[model samples]
Target: MKNKLEIKIILSLCFVTIITAVTAVPLQSAHAFSWPCIDRSDGKAPIAVSDDNVYVAWWGNTTGNYEVMFKASNDGGKTFGDKISLSNSTNGTSVEADVAAFGNNVYITYADNKTGDADAYIRTSNDNGKTFGPEFKLTNNSDSSLTSSSLPQGMKSYDNVKTSPYELKVAAEGDNVYVIATGGDKNDTTYQPDVFIRVSNDSGKTFGKDINLSESKGIVSERTEIGVLGDKVFVTWWDKGSDGTDTPLLRISDDRGQTFGDIIDLSANATDSNTTNTTSS
Candidate 1:
């Protein structure tokens, strides 16, 4: 009986060794996976990624006129769909375009010069960017200086430019969509560039009252980005001081951007003005 038990135990050990050897070769041969990049015929702006996809939006010259184009990838960054134009006007210029996707809808915010002023526009796509809704103007600046007329000469001067939206940012939490951009009053020289936050509960169909996030009076705060964690929304931007130095700043809102907390300095050293980039995780 002892000899028969020893024979059975040796047979079981041999079977285990065979199984391990068979699996080890395939495991050692495994390679890391890689993703594909989107092909932008004319690359322009940096890519932005949400929970599921990466959106690439840019302004490129099409037959001597600049227009906005977009491409999206659903599989992380594996592959992107074909390029699509967001503007219908021939001579209009679209610049500083930003895109963000939430749930089943994608929101694109950009500065359009079709109305003779650099008015803010938002376009929404519900079917995975297969089609977009009508272009809606977010601002009503009729001033000529804010719009682009022709090629080089019609471009608005930066110093005298007013009534235009710049550095657009969008973030969504639950059913609420929040957008932030810089708007300046053309008449008030003492009026610095202010951060305006607009909220929309029904996707991008309509937006609510503008909320000012900065209180520096005449100081300019630009290059803003928004992120949401739980019920709180955080905004980060570079606050430009009178000495021509830009300092990184951050503001947090615990109540869905309805109210923001005190400005928090994000720089490691308070006196260090050389750093230009800031982000919140």
Candidate 2:
């Protein structure tokens, strides 16, 4: 009788343990929902952040035609303000918008074909993204006609530095701003692209002439990048020379884009040059 009683007691303890375990499990976690910042299609967005402020620049066709659009979030993208059209072009289509931000200053640059030919343009904002200044044209490509000719080699055509049909990037630091692009020479019949740069020391108020960083003709230079650190500027690009081989090159400027030093070949041999090089300050 005692053995049978002990067996019943043990079974009772097992039942109680099973009931406690089932009750100890927590409930399922709630799933997080994704919020749509913009409800438009055909948008090519580029975003930049400065401290708690997040800025986004894109090109969308919500206004009948493609135009540059912008929006800001001061609380780390948790909430975004109303979308604003930065490039409200009436006669042209603005595309491929790029953005850069430093403190209270924000910049948006893109390409437009308002003048029958595509050109680079920029718009700046001082009070974050609340208001923006007037549209500023950055490129003036007057002649882009294709000509036929041939260069024997070791010669570079110094005519017609056209900035269109290629990607352009913008970088800003304090009172200085930079725009790096790939430009083609009108004189070179091969239409080889070269890396060019434009600098603005007064924080986008004014810009200097386009400086050729590649300085090589009949050879293609592309995928240009720029970085600024105080008074120092660094530019890098992938260059394919007459050997038909890709090489990574870099140029440094100590006077804030005023002048660049000699070309510093990142790779000495052709085998070592088939890679992308990036620079950051």
Candidate 3:
């Protein structure tokens, strides 16, 4: 009778345990949201969102050298994959990096001092962010002559130096990719930084002519950000006028950046005030 009673007790315990487990299991909550899966000890820039996922890239100083890092969240920022370092160089900083995703591919652009003058570089990953192609310097500043020390401070640096301080913006539509950057040749002292756009139809294999965006003479335009919706390409920047005042500006292009409409003043109230601005379409 004792043995029989022991067997009954064991069965009861097992049944209770199973019932508790079934009741304790947590269900997916509607409040659940995506979180960072990677360590963001370094500063992170604005992230780009596509249909499938979101991409975020950042720069950090590691062991006295600057490195570019990337992370992607598949479930709307709920979880991210392992972080990856894109740049192989050890000295230059990766400051203004931007990411864009289309279909299963992700494209990144940033300013790197690996070449010493803060030139622009690009990398693309086909199978999500699993792998990236070889790093390509978008601006050919490899020639040694383009340096402030080599030429007069006021001289143009197109042949000698390439100073592209702003982040490179990229948008992919259909099979073509469009990139925009702001830079100036060293010699045009009167020429503030100008926005330039390039297009690649062959899956980033080659790029086309550079198109200038800004026409304001002697006004310093910098920190450009770009976005695309359908055929419209919009760019926003902080422009420092000759009057020593800063303004937030936006320019839209309906013809794939071939031509731009009038500059829209986003901060009309704060015309001469220093205000940070951002826009998305």
Candidate 4:
């Protein structure tokens, strides 16, 4: 009789413990919602933050054709203001935009086929993203509008259909702006389009001549990016040499792009598939 009573008391305690656990759990808070900053084919958004202001530059299809769009949030990205078209053109599509912010000025650079051929373009905003100045065309590829390379050793080269296709990447510090763009060459593998650069020392107000970064006789170089640190500037790209191998290479300039050091092969040992050289591995 005593054991039976003890079992009943233990079951009663277990029931109370279960009830307390269920009641102690707090209810979850309600989910919050935010309005769409941009609608209609808005993607590839690159954002830059300066102080409390956050700026976004993206390629959108709001215009009949694709164009570069800009917006800013003064309240630390909680809300964004109305959209602004940095390209603001009705011509050929402007794609692949990159943005940078310094002080009160915001700079956005993109590639568009405004004229007969695609070219690199830049626009600046002095008052954050509220307003933009005039557009500046950077590259003059009147001869060859494209950069092309023979297929790597094992791959076959094919003609790619492109209309004024130019890829652009940009980096800026203070009033100095650096842009790297590659035009494709679908014809002769021996003579392909080159990776060229344009620099603007006085912000985006003006630009210098297109400085060719690759060898004049080497196979085509493409997929380039630029970075600036202190007095040095760095540029890197992928290239195909006559040896039939594709290589990733790097070039550095200590005097702010006036000249570049030797091209260092980044993928020199890529043929060794077993070699673990990358940090991610």
> Local distance difference test, per candidate?
0.58, 0.63, 0.57, 0.57
TM for every model, in the order presented, reads: 0.68, 0.71, 0.68, 0.67
1-281 per-residue lDDT for model 2 (tens digits): 21232332221111100000011222111000111112224346888888899999888776577788899998999999999988888777677678988888898887676665456778889988889999876754442333223432433331222223345678888888888766554444555666777777777888765566776667777777777788888989988878879988888989888788777788876665433232211
Error of 1 at 31 (Å): 56
Error of 1 at 109 (Å): 0.7
Question: Candidate 4: which pairs clash?
Answer: 146-183, 146-184, 146-185, 147-183, 147-184, 147-185, 147-193, 148-185, 153-244
lDDT for each residue of candidate 3 in 1-281, tens digit (9 for 90 to 100): 21232332221111100000011222110000011112223346657676768788877777576577899877788889998998766755565567777877788876666654445677888876778998866664332323454455654543322333354677876556677766553333453565556666555666655555554556666567777776777878877887888877787878655557767778776555432232211
- The lDDT, on a scale of 0 to 1, for candidate 2 is 0.63
Kindly report the root-mean-square deviation of model 2 from the true structure over all alpha carbons: 24.5
How much does candidate 2 score in TM-score?
Answer: 0.71
Name the weakest run of 10 consecutive residues (lDDT summed) in model 3.
Answer: 13-22
For candidate 2, list the clashing residue pairs, or say none: none
Error of 3 at 183 (Å): 1.7
- Angstrom error of the Cα, residue 228, model 1: value is 1.7
By descending TM-score, how would the candidates be arranged? 2, 1, 3, 4
